[model samples]
Target chain A: AQSVAQPEDQVNVAEGNPLTVKCTYSVSGNPYLFWYVQYPNRGLQFLLKYITGDNLVKGSYGFEAEFNKSQTSFHLKKPSALVSDSALYFCAVRDIRYTGGFKTIFGAGTRLFVKA
Target chain B: GAGVSQSPSNKVTEKGKDVELRCDPISGHTALYWYRQSLGQGLEFLIYFQGNSAPDKSGLPSDRFSAERTGGSVSTLTIQRTQQEDSAVYLCASSLPGSYGYTFGSGTRLTVV
Candidate 1:
């Protein structure tokens, strides 16, 4: 079974500092990795996805993710954090070889707090 | 619609009653999905539907939970005998065939008292 893990329950960072939310995944074959953001009482918004051909993928609102195949990690990163960036982050994975369907497995989620 | 649309942004029902949530996917989207989001628990996959194919109901929690997609555009998720544990936001997402990302709606906040 394909699964994704977000080791951090919450990550606190200072405004203007770099921020990173870690994610890792396990799958039988190549994995399709995605990052999503959720604001208070809002549905998830897609951040970025690593389908193929690129190790680093940039997404909406100055967010980017680095896909590390060796470590099975796709960590969400931002060069400088802002107060508005504080929200819940989720890492999801989809196995390319899965015959069932295109159902993505999401991690438990990591709450990000950027203090000003 | 420009994006996925879900009806009844908020819903409150008495326990043991039935509730239905609706979703309208983006125009031309070939796939639609239903997920549940609780306070702490992450998004839980509920069901999936593709153009005219048999929906993957594997993620449904119980027999009382059922869903139907009409004309491959609009979908309805019905939860019979709603319980307090079912109080959570139900989200709907849609994507084009083989698309890498999904566009999600604002979601319907269902509260079962």
Candidate 2:
């Protein structure tokens, strides 16, 4: 079964400092991992995805994530955080060879708090 | 619409009532998905519709929960005998067949009184 785990429920960081939100996954086939962000009263927005090529993928809002196959991890990172970066982050995964319909398994989500 | 769209931004109904949530996927997108979000809990997959294939309903919690996509573009999720536990934001998303990234709607917030 395909699944994602976000070890930290919440992450705290100061403005202008680097931040990292960890994620790991388990899938039978080649993993199609993605990162999404959700702000207050807003639906999830796609941050980035790892389909193939370059392990580090850049996304909107100056965010990026590194896909590590050996460690089964795809961690979201930002060089310098901002107060507006505070939001909920989710890690999701899917398998390439889908059987019936598509199912993107998601982690419980981590609440990011970038204190100003 | 430019992105996935959901109807009834907010809905309140008494327990035991039935409710229907609608989703309009982006033009030309073939896959649609439904999920529920609750306090402290992440998104829970409800069902998925892809092209003309039968929806994958394994994630549906019970028979009272059902969904259908019409003409492979518009989708509706229905819940019968709604309970307080069902009060949560119902989110809809759509994507291309091979694409892993999904475009999500603002979601419909349902409150079961």
Candidate 3:
């Protein structure tokens, strides 16, 4: 089974300061990791994904994530946070072997609060 | 190009009532998915449509929950005997074949009173 873990229930950061939302996963095969953000009353918006490339992957809205195989983690990072960036974050993992079958499993989700 | 679109942005119904939510995928997208987001469950996959075939229905919580996609474009999710626990945001997403990024719809908010 492919599963994702977001250790933090919520994260608070000051605007203009760097922010980090932690995520980890467990899978039977190679992992296809993804990050998505959801605003109130809206569907989730895709941020970035890590297939099989560089360790660091950049995404929309000045966000990025680092894929660490040894740690089994893919934490979302942003150098500078904005108040508007406050939203719910989810980490997802899809096993390569089940690419055509099973759906991607998402983490419980982490609420990010960027305060001014 | 338009993004995924879902109908009945918000629906309120009494217990035992049935509701139907519709989704229109992008013009060329071959993959469509339905997911439910609740306060306790977060986001849970309900069903997925690849072209006109749905190979996985394991995500549906119960027999009351059913979905179908027709002509490989439009999809409908029907919930029978609506329960208060079913109150949540139902989202739809579509993507191209072998594409990793998914385009999501605004989502329909279903409130079972």
Cα TM-score per model: 0.97, 0.96, 0.96
Candidate 2: tens digits of C-alpha lDDT, residues A3-96: 8999999999999999999999999878889999999989899999988899999999999999999999999999999999999999999854
How well is each residue in A4-108 modelled by candidate 3, as lDDT tens digits?
A: 999999999999999999999998777889999998777789999999989999999999999999999999999999999999999998745446543577899
Q: Report the lDDT tens digits of candidate 3 across residue range B1-113.
A: 48899999999999999999999999999888899988756689888888756446778999999998888889999999999999998999888888887888999999998
Tens-digit lDDT track of model 1 for A16-86: 99999999999877889999999987789999999888899999999999999999999999999999999
List the candidates ranked by TM-score, beginning with the highest. Answer: 1, 2, 3
| Tens digits of lDDT, candidate 1, B3-80 | 999989999999999999999999999889999988888889999898888998988999989999999899999999
Best-first order by DockQ: 2, 1, 3
DockQ of each: 0.60, 0.69, 0.58
Supply candidate 1's per-residue lDDT for B71: 94
Decide which is better by lDDT, 1 or 3. Answer: 1
Model 3 error, position A77 (Å): 0.2
Residue A20 lDDT, candidate 3, scale 0-100: 99
On DockQ, the leading prediction is 2
Off by over 4 Å in 1: A97-101
List per-prediction Cα lDDT, in the order shown. 0.92, 0.92, 0.89
- Choose the strongest candidate by lDDT: 2
Model 1: residue B35 alpha-carbon error in angstroms: 0.4
